[model samples]
Each structure stands twice: as C-alpha cells, then as structure tokens.
Target: MTTFGSQSDVIAFLSEPSAYGVSDLVKRIDTHAAIIFLAGDRAYKLKRAVRYPYLDFSSAEKRRLVCKAELALNRRTAPDLYLEVCSIGRLDDGSLALGQGSPVDWLIVMRRFAAKDLLDAMAREGRLEPKLLRELADGISRFHELAEIETHHDAVGRVRSVIEGNRVSMAKLPGMPLAACDRARLFTSSLVLLDQLTPLLARRGEAGLVRHCHGDLHLGNICMWQGKPVLFDCLEFDAGLATSDLLYDLAFLLMDLWQRGLRDEASLVFNRYCDRRAETDGLAAMPLFLSMRAAVRAHVEARGSDLQPDVKGRKDKLVTARRYLASAVGFLDRPEPRLLAVGGLSGSGKSTLAARLAPRIGTAPGVRLLRTDMLRKRLAGVDPEAHLPESAYTRETHDAVYAALLEEARKTLDAGWPVIVDAVFDFPATRAQVEALARAVAVPFSGLWLDAPRDLLHARVGTRRGDASDAGPAVVDKQLERDVGFLGDWQCVDARGDAQQTLEHAIAALGSECPIG
Candidate 1:
C-alpha cells in the first residue's frame, strides 16, 4: 500500500481503483463517497473523508458504523451482494489488510460483479428488462416492510432536518448553477406548503410509514447479482435521514426515471410497487416528495457541475436543473376532475371494487385512489402492518381519520384529477363533508357502496393478509350497533353477490362518465 498524506497524494486512488481491473476504472464516476477496488472476486470499498450534512464518514469509528449500517441494510434489499463489513486497521508493520490484519481504517468488502451489469449500465446499453423493474419494486417493498420504523416525533424531525440541512449544503458549496439559485428561490416561496404538510405529520405518524430505507435508492445503486437485482451502498450514517416516509425514498427513483425521459419504465416500476405493497396514504406525500427530490436533484447536479471542464457540461447541468424544476412545477398543473368514493363496512368489498373500477374511470393515463386504511395507519404514526392497541379506536381518532379523508378528497379533486376515496364514509357527517369538497371543486362526485351481510364481512376480515387495518368482525359488529349503512341519496351496490359481479356493477357505474377523454 502506498503512503499518502494529502489530497494530491490521493491521486493514487484513480489509478489504484482500476488496479482491480482496468476495464472497471475506464467506465465512470465522480463522487467523493467511496472508491472501488477489486481483490479476487470481491470489491473492497474504501470510504472518503467527506462529511456532508446528510452523512459523515470523516472519522474512523464513523466510517465503521456507516459501513456496518450499509451491510445490514443492503442485506435486506440486496442480500446476495452485501457480504460483510471488513474493519480496516494498521497491522504490526503499519499497513492495512482489511480484517486479515489490522489497524488504519474501515472498509466494506463486497462481492464484485460486472460493472456493466448495474441497472444504470443496463439502461444505457438498452438491456434493462421489464421483469427486472418489477423485481426491483418487490425487493424494495419487502425490504421496507422489514426495516425498523422510527417513532412519530423522530420521523418528522428527521425529514424536516434533511430539508433544513440541504439549505446548508446550498450555502457552503462553491459551485451552484444559476438555475439552482432560482430553484432555491422557488422552494423558499413555496414554504407555505409546509403548513399543509405539517398537519399531515400526525396522520402519517399514525399510519407508520417512517422506516430506515436505502437512503441512496437511485439506478446506479442497484445491480443484478446472480441474475437477480441487488441494491447496494445504502446510507448508514444518519438515522434521521434514513428514517423517513417510504414514498420520499421511493420518489428518488421514480423522479430519476421520469427526469431521464424513461416515463414508460417509471410507470411500470410504480404500477408494480402499487400492485404488490398497496399503500395509499403515500399518495398525499408522494407529490410533495416528488417535488423535493427533484429539487435535491437540481442541487446535486448543479453543485457537481463545478468540477466539469467543458462549457457544454455546464450548460447540460443547467438544463438538468430546468428539467427538475419543471417536474416540481408540473405537480401543481391541471389535475383531473372527478370524485369516486368507495364505501362499505370493513370487508364489504370496498377495496376490491374500487381497485377494479379505478382503471375504467379516472383521467385514463392516471387516477389516484386514496384509501383510509393507509391514511389512518400513516396518521397513527405506525407501520401499516403493525397492530395498534384496541384503545386506538376511540371516537376522537375516528373523527380525525374522517377529517383526513375529507382533506385528501379536497386536495386530490382540486388537482384536476379523478380520485377514488376508499373508506366506509359510514358516518353521515363524513360522507357529507367529503362530498362538499367535490361540489366546491365543481366536479361530479360519485359514491359506490359495497354491501354484504354482516356474516360475509366478518369472514373477509378474518382472512386478510399483510394489511395494517383494524377493521374486522368485531369492528363490523360495533358498526352494526351504530347503524353503518348508506343513508342519503347516494349510489349503493350489492357486494354480496360474488366480488366479480359486484366489481362489474361498480365498473359500469364508473364508465358511464369515464373521466378519461
């Protein structure tokens, strides 16, 4: 190993990185994160002493902790790729040999795979498969489900802190594009939106989507190991940053694909995720998150552009800033107009019918379906799959939930987009409240009530899976005690006659005034 003491001495890294394989070094990269060197069939990762606000690997123990976090988190998302964390220290002779010897620094040793096979490379080489995207979604969803979620207060603090910290990144950085300056201004102007998002924190806390995620879930961080997708290099340093709303983490990739002009693939990935994990409270957070991620992208690209030598690279980076800005602005553009509310007692077929009828209505290319189970779970500040105590069903909590549903309905309809609100809307107050949102937006509001005898509703709830809702036979019985059936001049559909037949009726009801042109 060569002895180096200063920044210039680190020049050896550029040549040494490819010392593993010349071909690997010839490909690409320019981040102060880690350097890749191959030893046998394994890749040895050495962290840089860069201490950005969002992460810090500037010290020996800090690097070790971060490396361990990376190993543990990546193992969940890409189990085959992350082998183990190898502590690096000086040996008796004062040289580093990973864990074989001892004592200078810490390095994460990973199994080496072909660099050409990373998801980014595959996309560039026109070799990405549809199945690969689907698998990626599945892996991420499962990983998220298993990851630990922070408590509600910590979750909110972590997220807001990231935003505040990024401001520090903006100020201290030497190179920021003019467009980036404009973007910072735009976001500063939009800070009022934070008030809208602030109230949501309580609801989201209850729903419980705040988990430790693959902090850097971009295309470049994913690869195929043994013919399956493997995610790597997750952030390990900042628990606050990693512990956040799941949709905020997901928006990085979705925004990446959308920014890259790969809308079709983006849609495929998004649809696959929705189909598998099926959480809807994120719908409210996603657009807001998409904007933030795009803003981050603008800053990262613009700041990094300072290292480029050519004028074109500089202009291209500015263009990237514009692209991200446009994406953020697009969220507020004309949203489709229609309200589709799905109601029935728990297990009365509301979800199934709404899921089926959604595609037939809405503004064709897209329609948002907002579900109470997801929103309520998020509001509870707990994972959607975790069971809350029985006391969580207090009347106050139910009222807060309906208030959230009404809020979601208003925001969604105002966006000029068709939406499906999936909740019992059992209370007259709740139904009338949300219907008013549709009327205020001057949009036609439609409601579909899925009905079944109490017996079947009980059966469906007892057999549910991977869902965090508290509705069951007991909840249904309690509702029955309070008269939980449709009472106003609202559309009602029989859900007892087979879910398929019930779905058809709902679909027919929706198609009569399909939102899609």
Candidate 2:
C-alpha cells in the first residue's frame, strides 16, 4: 500500500473520478469532520484531518479506525447503505487509485440514496403520514430493544454531562441571542429539573435502560428507504456520545418534531414508542431530556451561525438558534398537572380523543394516557391487540383492571405528571371511584363522557383493526344494554362527528381546564 505524506495528496487523488472507476462528474459534501464524495450511485466518505476537543482524526491511523467504526456502527441500522471501507492509495507512477497501492487514507464506501427521501424532507413536503410516523416509532422501538445495554455508563451522569456541556458551549458563543437574565433562568430551571429527576435517571440506568443508541436521531438522520424508515449516520466518533438512556436518545427526534411545529406527530411517536416498550415511567424525565436536546440543537445552531461566510446566512442561523433556545426554555416550564377521564362505550371514540388530547393536555411531551383496555391486556399477560376470552372480562377481572389503572394513575400523579384515563366507566361506582381518586390527589379533574347512537357505535366497532380495544360490534351491542349512571357534572361530547370536530368539541368543553393550546 502506498502512503501519502500529506492529506492534500490523498484529497487530490480522490478528486479524480477515474480513481473510483466512475464518470468524471463528482459531487462533494463537507461537514465538520468528513468530506463525502458522491460519484455515480455510490458515495465515499473520507474523514478530514482535523482535531477537536471531543474528537481527533488528525492521523491516518485514527482516520482509518474511525472510518471502520462508522461503517460497523452504521451497518446496525442501515446495512444496505454502508457498503465497506476501502483504501485510497498512490500508484507507482505517482497516481491515485481506489482499493489498490499503499493505503494512504481510508474511505467509507456506501450505497447512496436520494436526499429528498429523508424524513425531514418528507415533513417539509407535507408527505409525512401518520402511518409512516408509527412505522418509524416501531422501527426505533425495535432497535432500542435490541441495542446493547451499556453497563458502565451512568444515565444520570450522562445527562449531567450533557447539561454541563451545553452550558459550556453556550457560554462560548461570541454573541448569544438570549438575554443574560433569560440565559440564567433557563440554566437554573434546567438544573432544577435535572436535580428532581436524578433518582429516576439512576433507577432507569440500573434497570439497563442505558444502551448504545442512535445518538443523532433527528429527522434528518432518518430516510424512507425500501419503503421503510431506515436510521443511519449514528454518532460513531465517540462511544460516550452514543451511549445513554434510551429515552434521551429518542428525545432528539421528539425535540426536532416539536421545534418544527409537528406537535401531533411528535406526541404520536412518543406514545407509540412508549406503548411498544412499555415505558410510561420514563415520561417524568421527558421534559428534562427534551430540554437538553433542544439546548444542544440551539448551541449547535448558534455555533453554526459563526461558521457561515455571509452576513445574511449568519443572521438567519442566529434567529433559528434563538428560537431553539426559546423552545428549550419552554420545555423546562412545567405546567399544572390535572387528571382527565374520557369514558364511553365501545366505538364512541373515547380512546381516539384520549390519544389526541394526551399530547396537548399538560407539560412537555404531554400526559400519560392510562387506557383500561391496555391495562387489562397487560394484566391478562397478552398482547394489546389480542382478543381475551369472555371470562377475562368478568366482574373480578374488570375490578382488577380498574384497580390497576387507579394504582398507575396515583403513581403518575404522585410523580407530578398529568394523566388521562380512557375507559368505558359504564357503572356509576366506577365513575365515582375515578372522581374520588382525582379529589384524593388534590389535582383538577375533568371527566368527559362520549355519546353516540347504537348504530354508529356498532359501525365504528365493526371497522376496528389492530387496536388495543378488543371490543367489536357484539361488545358494543352488549354495552348498549348496560345502565350508564347519571351524567352529573361530567361533560358530554358528541362522538358521531368526525375526529377533528370531536376534538374541537372536547377542547371547547375543557375550556380553562386545558391550559396548553
């Protein structure tokens, strides 16, 4: 293998398209640490000869090692994209060649795809469907399940490090957009949140929640490939950056969606992922995690402003950076916790309303939706979509499910997070119990009962697919015969209308009870 004395020689050699056995046309994209050369249908990534406080790729050996790491780590999520690491070398006649001669520098070869297929691009084009969002959440959940748990990494310590790093980075900015008072307030609030969540973070880490995950999980790092959302470009330079609590890893994507005004999509992803992982307890840490993620983006964007060559570009980036900082502060501002119950018979759209309202009910990342159907399924030790035997819905099982919901709600409320209970609540006793539970907790409580005609309920139930509720038309017919106690002070929402209209009616009924818009 040929060795080049300087990085310039290697760059000069790779600039020639003939070395890659492709046409003369070459497209190059440069980042802080790497230069990606796209030729034909393949791309070659070469680590730049650079050294930073967090990373070092100054030497050929270091570059080669990082290139290998990039290839290996990326293959875990995007096997089809990361091809292999090849060598860039000089020939005997002082010419450059790929995969031949003495190895001068390492290049990561990858199969290239269209940039417009990225999730961020889809979101910008308004092509981001709910189905795609759910699929993305599912894919991320599966990856987290299979990710290697890092036993040595302390979750709380990692979060502390991130907070400290953000502080240091923001302090280093030449002209920070935030006022001194605002900066101090945001920092203090963030620290307070971190202090409050230290115990939960430690417990989560001890429970093996700390895993080697996709550190950069924003929409830009994901793309629609092969009709599926494939995650790539993970943080391969530093293991410390990549290893953390799984929820914190997910916060990056959540923060991205929230900042982009995709609030519903962000909430949907959060709930779907939590449902798949059965990780509702982590919701308490979401505000801190999301704030940290936003702070990170803010500082990064602020630093990017300095890197821009033009005044207008720098000003625009500064504006974006300030907005991210504001979002970070907003995340830290906790809202008043309240308990909400949405009750109805099968196919009355109670669950749909719960799902839609949960994200907008309280603080960052929304409320914990405690659905009795899901609790019942969990109690039965069956899949959520699994149909339980008729015996499973007996009075004893029913009471057990309600008890479980109450217990969970208590814990969630005790943790200072809002909760939304979705259940049939057909019996007067059940309704009274929920109201009493909220009173006992001393939180503002609102109960919403959905009403729809029998025929409409039956039609809606008949179309149920892969949902947590096992209720079918037969179940709806039986529920029609049950006596639902007096409405009392609870609000009634017309469920026969479309979902958006129903949501509007629910919000209207909520009025001042719902503080978050």
Please name the candidate that would achieve the greatest TM-score relative to the true structure: 2
Report lDDT (CA) for all predictions: 0.67, 0.84
Model 1, 1-517: lDDT tens digits are: 1222343323253335443444544233455466665655777777766665556666667778888877877777667777877765446864334465554566666777887978888888877766688778878887778878766455556556666665565555554443556556646644545556665655676677777778778888888878888777776777667777887788788777766666556655664565456544455455556666776665576665654679898778767766766676554333456787788888888876665555445322245667777667768777656688889888898888778777766765554557778888788878877788788889887777777898898999999876657777888898777765455756778888777899767666656555432
Model 1: how far is 22 from its true place, Å? 11
Please give, for residues 395-475, the per-residue lDDT of candidate 2 as tens digits.
Answer: 899999999888888877877789898999989999999999989999989999999999999899899887888888888
- Candidate 2 residues lying further than 4 Å off, grouped into runs, are 1-16, 174-182, 306-309, 376-397
Assess candidate 2 and give its lDDT: 0.84
* lDDT of model number 1: 0.67
Model 2 TM-score on a 0 to 1 scale: 0.91
User: Residue 311 CA error for candidate 1 (Å)?
Assistant: 5.4
Error of 2 at 478 (Å): 0.7
Candidate 1 off by > 4 Å: 1-28, 38-40, 87-102, 125-128, 152-155, 306-315, 332-334, 337-366, 369-517
TM-score of each: 0.63, 0.91
